[model samples]
Target: MKTLTLAATAILLTAGFASAQTVRIGTEGAYPPYNMINDAGEVDGYERELGDELCKRAELDCTWVKNDWDSIIPNLVSGNYDAIMAGMAINEERQKVIQFTQNYVPPQASAYAAMSADADVEGGVVAAQTGTIQASHVAETGATLVEFATPDETLAAVRNGEADAVFADKEYLVPHVEESNGELVWIGEDIALDEGIGVGLRQSDTELKDKFDAAIASMKEDGSLNEMIGKWFGEGAPLFE
Candidate 1:
């Protein structure tokens, strides 16, 4: 996308932060078009590209580290990684535990997918990834919320009749439904929650947070961030701009 100006690159180099030399970005490598393990067994996808660009613009040596979605935050708190670029949403509850860079991706619609078009979306068993906004929403609907550690498991639960439907980010579920042909179909209205998606850093790492925030801001200003979103999520995908 956008190339860093010489002046901006020089400023990042002179920022004098130790973490600037080797920042490890943690992510759930199971989410496609966001983050995924490629055939070569390495982290690959949208966040991979976006994270690399941010690191380059900030002049930081960086690498990717894969972690399960459920324990991603805990691992970051425990110093397993320096930052999270895992398509994590920014909300008040998460903000209580860690700091976030300004949102790089805008809030997206969450939806439900089921084996049949008439499947019950309310007051029925529902599957969702543990520790996610969709899980919380399903719980509040008086539905039996079956929590899974991963997104794929939620879809499996529905396919196997363990749950009537799966609630998740619409983008993440779209491909699964397409691949399933007519076996799976989207049901119910779209749910919108959280402000947007952002990079997460420990509360104590203000310098690292600032560095990434500036990098994200620069991408937004140069239209590179929107370009990346379109490339990965399709032309009609929502953008930060």
Candidate 2:
């Protein structure tokens, strides 16, 4: 039975190896300024735009797949995808589960204070996404955390007073506030998460990981990365700076 099991594992491994060249990218098509699904059901946003740019630089044929935000990292680890490009912030906790490319995009955090006292959020109070830097700080500061799946929900939570404040990437939330009818302020202070956004891969796939790093370096040197960032994020954005 052990012999049989080993043989089956070998066959599966061989198949995985054979098809590894074409990198599969996973994302949540609902996180705007990172990844979002358009009305046409196509993924678009800064991360999506960056993914295409990386593929071009690496000369790799890439295929992008959209999944829920909560499932992206799990799917990548399960081999459902070769990498993750969901505007994910690379922190030490996540590093235990997967490897990440060099910081392609610097990390930026934004905080939004509530404009009302009657807003309704889960648990009727808190700030920032759970497990995020803001949440950690709130926890330490003895404040409650009202977690949400998307920035829209987070911002809405603040507007309605369900949350005392909301925190996330400025690039993601600033545009949202600008377009909203509410009066959310930047607070002029950001919580630096000490993380950078990067492509995620299996911890053992050094070769593939190196390719992504090389591609990113090339893109930066050739100004393609800057151009892509400017195109997606606009000039003088804090995330880009």
Top-TM-score structure, candidate number: 1
- Winning candidate number (lDDT): 1
Record all residue pairs in model 1 with backbone atoms less than 3 Å apart, i.e. clashing.
none
TM per prediction:
0.92, 0.81
C-alpha lDDT values of all predictions? 0.88, 0.69
Q: What's the distance in Å from true for residue 183, model 1?
A: 1.8
What does candidate 2's lDDT look like per residue over 1-241, in tens digits? Answer: 0112433423433332234367889988877767888888898888877888777655567888987766777788898989989877888878999999886776666454455434332334666754455566565654567677666777778767677667667777767767666676555356677577889899988867766776676655556666777777777854332
lDDT, candidate 2, at 142? 49
Tens-place lDDT digits, model 1, residues 79-113: 99999988888988899999998888888889999
**Backbone collisions counted per model:** 0, 4
- lDDT for residue 209 in candidate 2, whole number 0-100: 74
